[model samples]
Target: MDAIILQVLNGLDKGGAYALIALGLTLVFGTLGVVNFAHGALFMLGAFCAVTFKKIITLEQIVLSKTELSPWGTPLEIRTPYAQQWFGDFGNVLIEYSVPFSLLLAIPVMLFIGIAMERGIIKHFYKRPHAEQILVTFGLAIVLQEIVKAFFGANPNPQPIPQIFMGAADLGVMVGMAENVITYPKWRLVYLFFSLGVIAAVFAFLRFTTFGLVVRAGMSDRETVSMLGINIDKRFTIMFGIAAVVAGLAGVMYTPILPPDYTLGMDFLVLSFIVVVVGGMGSLPGAVLAGFMLGVVQSLASMTEVKDIIPGIDQIIIYLIAVIILLVRPRGLLGKRGVMEN
Candidate 1:
């Protein structure tokens, strides 16, 4: 029973990432029909945004301590983050909350990246073959990877979460089970809520607002929307930016879960593409749904008893499910008719 609960929680955590990335992919593909191979690179950039902010916050001044000396009789030097020295309590708070505060840096950086990619590169390929689009964007991904590596080095950098979220939550007590019977990390739970909040905000923006209505209308019929005098191209470009923000923020929040590395974006890129495919091309809800479902499936496959029966099941479970779904549903669980169709 405990094992089941644990796996489910783990699934939700993993699903949050999958769903967020795939959701961004859906936005671009569903509306613009552009297969963005560089989306994962956007995610990687976002994680590095967090790293950059962390470095900025932790920038320190070294001073000789009058009362302290090293074992070799040299004056001890002290290092303190700028935020800590500038704001005192607030500075400490900023340092403690650096991970979440990175949003300020990530949003603008990712927005610029998305817009530049679209206007400068992607728009030109809108009418080109998918093979050409793939080649160009794949090249862009490599370029982004090298740029990051050149600046940040090839080492993995770990980001710290707030002190308040450092420990596990007692889910067993909350659910009326014995205390400690079903404990889970607080940050993971926080991450799940954060992911859900972002997803909800995206849906709300698209469903309730006038801009969203226009975007939806354009998705249904681009020529019709253009005929009605709406600049569908500009809106599509903005949507691409929004997608970049989504991928970026997901990476920002996920830094503590997985350390930031130059290859992080590429790592998640393949899985997210598989997710987008399995969810059906150009299906928003399908992408979101498959993200969570695959996450749960992957988690369950990692269990001891399950693995005992099927060696290496956990690692291959996601790919296996992808194959089965492709064979059975083809368009995915909630994908619309005629999308990627015969």
Candidate 2:
């Protein structure tokens, strides 16, 4: 029973990330009818944003000290972060929580990148063939990855979680299991709640606000929204920015759990697409539901006994389920008839 609980927790942790990325992908595809292969790059950029902020916060200048000297040197050179010189305790705390603070930095940066991509490149491909869109965007994704590799290198860069949430919480005691029988990372728990809050906020923005109502209406019937003088083109562009922010934020929050490399975006891209397909393209609820469901399925499939029986079931569990779902419901679990049928 305790093992089951642990597996469920792990699944939810992985599922939250899948749902977040898939939600953003569905948004762009559903809203603009453009196939964006570069969405995952935006996610990678978000992780790098955190890295950049950390570098900036810890910028150090060498200073020669008169009183201190090295064994073989005439004078000692001291390195100190500018933040430390400018602000003492607060700066330390800021660096200590840089992962969370990166959210603020990521929002504006992602918005700019998204708008730029939309206006400069994606804008021209709106009415083009999906193949063309995919080719161009995939090229863009590769370019972004190469740029990151050039600057940050191809190796994974680790980001620190806040000291406050570093250790594991004993769920065993809290849930009436044997003492120390179940433990999970506190940061993972924080991440789960944070993801839920972000998802809820996004849905509320789309469902309860006028901007969202207009956007939803546009998604359903763009000609009518435009005919009504809603300027949905501009709104859709903004929605693109929002989608980028969504992906970026997910990447930002994920750095502590998964150290990011240049290829990180490509790694999640296919899996997120699979989630979107299984959830029913353009279906937000379906994406979220499928994400969690697949997560649990994956967790169960990864058990040693199951793997022993099936021999690599864990590796193909998601794809297997996706195949099964698509076979049964061709349009996806909750997909509307007209969506992506062409």
Count of clashes, each model: 0, 0
| Shift of residue 18 alpha carbon in model 2, Å | 0.6
Q: What is the TM-score of each candidate against the true structure?
A: 0.98, 0.95
Question: Residue 113 lDDT in model 2?
Answer: 93
Poorest 10 consecutive residues of model 1 by lDDT? 333-342
Q: lDDT of each prediction vs. the true structure?
A: 0.92, 0.90
State each model's C-alpha RMSD to the native: 1.0, 1.7
Candidate 2: tens digits of C-alpha lDDT, residues 1-342: 777778989989888888888889889988998888998898999999999888888799789999989888789989888888789988888789999998999999999999999999999999899999999999999999999999998889999989989999998899677788889999999888888988999999999999999999999999999999889999999999999999999999999999999999998888888898899998989888887778888998898878999999999999988888778887788899978754
Candidate 2 lowest-lDDT run of ten: 333-342
- Tell me the lDDT of candidate 1: 0.92
Please give the RMSD of candidate 1 to the true structure: 1.0
